[model samples]
Target: MTRNTLEQEYDIVVIGGGTAGPMAAIKAKERNRDLRVLLVDKANVKRSGAISMGMDGLNNA
Candidate 1:
């Protein structure tokens, strides 16, 4: 097996790509366009988390 190394720097790092995670990252970047915002999630960002699992039901209610 081979090992791969990755390194990056960011002003803000948001854990989770859930409902709030993405919004928070967007807001941070809006506040400071120069900021390097990083959003990390264990699962696929697009179709994962509460939003994917029908959290919008709560909002609609």
Candidate 2:
């Protein structure tokens, strides 16, 4: 929930902040501990995926 500054330089920057964005950032960080990852999205990613909907679930949808 921290606001990232534009001046920061991340080893990997994920623009969509969707399911893939988090996955990619985690893997990248794991592979390189020194790597800095930035995830950005236009909307609240917490509510964007199927898991967040809490209904039929994302896979079923």
Candidate 3:
């Protein structure tokens, strides 16, 4: 890694692995089966966003 490394390569790099990122990655993958997809964010992406803050905006909404 380098201090100036914004990025070097990637077919697609999505920030904020929320509902959109995952869906985008999935769609991009479907569009090009050979593409390399990356989902990244400062927050814990493994856990769904918004809902993690004790806000059930999507929970049965």
lDDT of each: 0.72, 0.61, 0.62
TM-score of each: 0.73, 0.60, 0.57
Tens-digit lDDT track for model 2 on 1-61? Answer: 9997667677778766555656677678789989877767666544564344453232121
What digit string (tens of lDDT, one per residue) describes model 1 on residues 1-61? 9999999899999887677877788788789999998877777644566674665442222
As a whole number from 0 to 100, the lDDT of residue 22 in candidate 2 is 62
Report lDDT (Cα) of residue 60, candidate 3: 18
Itemize residue pairs with steric clashes in candidate 1: none
Q: In model 3, which regions exceed 4 Å deviation?
A: 1-8, 51-61
lDDT of 3 by residue, 1-61 (tens): 6576475678899776545656677788889999987767566633566444553342212
Cα RMSD for candidates in order = 5.3, 7.1, 6.5
Q: What TM-score does candidate 3 reach?
A: 0.57
Those runs of model 1 whose alpha carbons end farther than 4 Å from true positions after fitting are 53-61
> Looking at model 1, which ten-residue stretch has the lowest summed lDDT?
52-61
Error of 3 at 38 (Å): 0.8
Off by over 4 Å in 2: 1-6, 49-61
Candidate No. with top lDDT:
1
